[model samples]
Target chain A: MSTPSKTLGDYVLGLADDALVSAQRMGWWISRAPQLEEDLALANIGLDQLGQARTLLSYAGQLEGDGRTEDDLAYLRDEREFRNVWLVERAQSDFGVTMARLLLFAAWQSELYAALASCPDPTLAGVAGKAVKEVAYHLDHAARWVVRLGDGTEESHQRMQAALDAEWPYLDELFRPVEGAVVDPASLHPLVLARIEPVVAEATLEVPQVAPARGGGRAGLHTEELGYLLAEMQHLHRSHPGATW
Target chain B: MRDWPLWEVFVRSRRGLSHVHVGSLHAPDAEMALRNARDVYTRRQEGVSLWVVPAAEIVASDPGERDAFFDPADDKVYRHPTFYNVPEGVEHL
Candidate 1:
């Protein structure tokens, strides 16, 4: 494990990476959604998450005191260099599966940001405060769908449960502490877990009874899926270096 | 497959204001209705609060009654405060 930087800069980058990758994955579904309204909804959510990623990444870059900007980090990073969890990199399987992932991710992020809002650093605090509100709405959006699908018709219920089962293993990777990570899991775990468990239980989904995947995000190791994600996301930038919008 | 019902959305930009009607969308139920409303109507940060009502539930005044219901009020000069005397110290009427 590499020695962790205690600075908020390093920690914020981790958070930003998580949002950035998830946003990219969600954005991939723009015209591919099963329905038109859903296409718009996912796109909107993707934009919101991207907005958050931009804010956090820009702040992280500034705090690092390196010459890198948000665009530099977002456009230039290699697949192995990104620190997002594997769950976010996985392809969207179906609407139900996407909702399941969104529910889990949003619930965790909302709690994480709520706690982060009280951090000693004012910039971190302010960012978290703003982000928490957005994430709360996102969680509500996902939670309501979970309940609707869980309690709906036989087909919906079955699909919802299957979605839960399929995504359950990935949940563990979210909370697994990054070795020598700047953020203290000891301090943040209770707060994040307390908020996540009840929501999962309420959805009538079984929490993962299995061991966590040997998560390697912070170590810059990633699932095979990430390479494809990076290829699609960075293709424009990599092909035409320094191309402007 | 049956399509979801259409819903009308209203959003309040902030507190102490009525939710002004924005647009309409289709959703499975009230929960999804609200979510759809938020995503479609409030993407530009134009709202701080949202209200979703089924398009079927809203009882709007008849357009044919516009003259009978609203035009009459325009002629009622007593309702206007323009004729009322205002104290000099009053900052707002």
Candidate 2:
């Protein structure tokens, strides 16, 4: 059970990166969602994640003591420097797939945030307190979609099941060890699964028994997807230098 | 064929207020209709409560019958309480 101790800043940085990357992917749904309402839904969800990322990233910079601002950490870092799990970095081109991933990620985050809401670090505790509410809504929205699609027409059911199967392997990465996290990531495993299992069952989708993917995003090992995501997300910030909106 | 049914959204901006009609959205069912209403109408802190009704379920006076439905009320000014003068200390009135 021996694990290298990670700095608190690193722990917070991982949470920040998860939100940042998810926000970027969610932003892709703008103008591309299945309906206008869905477009707005994705936009709102992305904004929530973006807000969480901003606060966490800014706090992480302060904790690091290296004078790295939120922008510096977010826009300046390469793919290899990010600490998010692989679950969020993958492309979510399919709506069903997006819902499946959001359901899993939000479920895990809800538990993590709830546990951290009372932690020793005030900033992390405060961030987790607010984030818990947001993730609760996020999880509900995703679960509703997952259930609808999973129990809907033939085509939708197939797609929803496929989406669940596709994303299940990535779920394990979320429970990987984090030395400085307020709660054990492993402890959130059963809670997350319990949250997800009912939704999957209701949706009539099988909990995929696939093997876990090779994941080490916490240590900067990421899939090719992260590189493309970083390129697009950082492009404007890096290009504009000191440009003001 | 249209994919979903239309729903009329009603939102209460705060407590102790009647739900006001906000707008409409298309959703597969009532649950999603409520969720869509939230995403579309309540994104900017617009509402504290939301209700979604199937658009087909709401009955409305036909536009062509507007005069028949409301013309009678126009001549009845007595229905309004504006003519009454308030007493000297009738603060709330």
Candidate 3:
């Protein structure tokens, strides 16, 4: 069977979009985190994600040989043009929900980046190598929270479990195969799950059993939340079009 | 849930150096405290190592006893090596 064709630009953009959207969501918790320390931690995590997004997006723009700069791709694109996973686009408000989402996202990212680090693409490999370290920290932060909140108080435990269950449907979306991509999402599932299952068990929490959400975010289709997210993220840049800070 | 107790953070920027006081954060346990310190204080690659001590466990000199605690050392100029002529080649004296 002949292999399908996939552009390196498109593949990098998908990873970029995931980090960019996730960073945006993570930034929302800066001042509103449960505690001051947590506020700092979450903000740092957001900055790391944003850094990865910037590098990947810039690389994507370069690979496409489009005259568009990183800012153009980030701010000028509409909701349908973004290629992030749905898992990062959901509105995450509650602390438990945020932790659950982060745990899964970071876990997947750690495995994904580790694999991509060895891929034939050097730019992709360099970006992935740098990103894997940051993602490891993110995964640790989320894991600690998951275990804490999952095993903490009666209310916290219940809420953490609910958060896990609510986010579980989105898990399968991360493992969906990408055709002709250097990184295989399906190959990452078992490794990511290995990292997650022990944490869940240690937290005295049960892994949720639920059907996977239908994912089309990789095809430039996202949840309704992405529309609102883009509106807020793009407003300033779009209003002044090409104005620098 | 209730707020975690405060932990004082110290970060050693490199090996073979002492961990210096950085700042403080709140965590339920020592493990989480160290992790929080890593996140909050070392985000900028500030340290190679970290130390977190429970604030409650620290023993501090009373500020009200400033004179009794630290004044005695002020007059001890003899404790300074300046009284002796330092040999030119002597280092870290």
Whose TM-score is greatest here? Answer: 2
Q: Which of 1 and 2 is the better model by TM-score?
A: 2
Top-lDDT structure, candidate number: 2
Residue pairs with clashing backbones, model 1: none
Give a tens-digit lDDT track for model 2, residues A145-191: 99988999999999999999999999999998886777899999999
Which lDDT tens digits does candidate 3 get at residues A146-167? 9988998999999999999999
Off by over 4 Å in 2: A1-6
Instruction: Judging by lDDT, tell me the better candidate of 1 and 3.
Output: 3
lDDT of each: 0.79, 0.91, 0.89
- Candidate 3 lDDT score at position B47: 98
Per-residue C-alpha lDDT of model 2 across residues B15-82, encoded as one tens digit per residue: 99999998899988888888889889988899999999999999988999998988999989999998
User: Lowest-lDDT window of 10 residues in candidate 3 chain A?
Assistant: A1-10
State the number of backbone clashes in model 2.
Answer: 0
How displaced is residue A163 in candidate 2, in Å?
1.2
Please give each candidate's TM-score. Answer: 0.83, 0.95, 0.93
On residues A1-245, what C-alpha lDDT tens digit does candidate 1 reach at each position? 32233355666777888899999988988888766677888887787789889988998788777778998889898877787877778887588888888987887788778777887767778878888888887777777778777777889888888887777677777666654333455566566567556766776665556656676786578888888888888889989998998
Q: Model 2 - which docking category? A: medium
Ignoring the other chain, what TM-score does chain B have in each prediction?
A: 0.85, 0.90, 0.89
Name model 1 segments beyond 4 Å from true: A1-10, A34-36, A179-182, A186-190, B14-17, B59-93
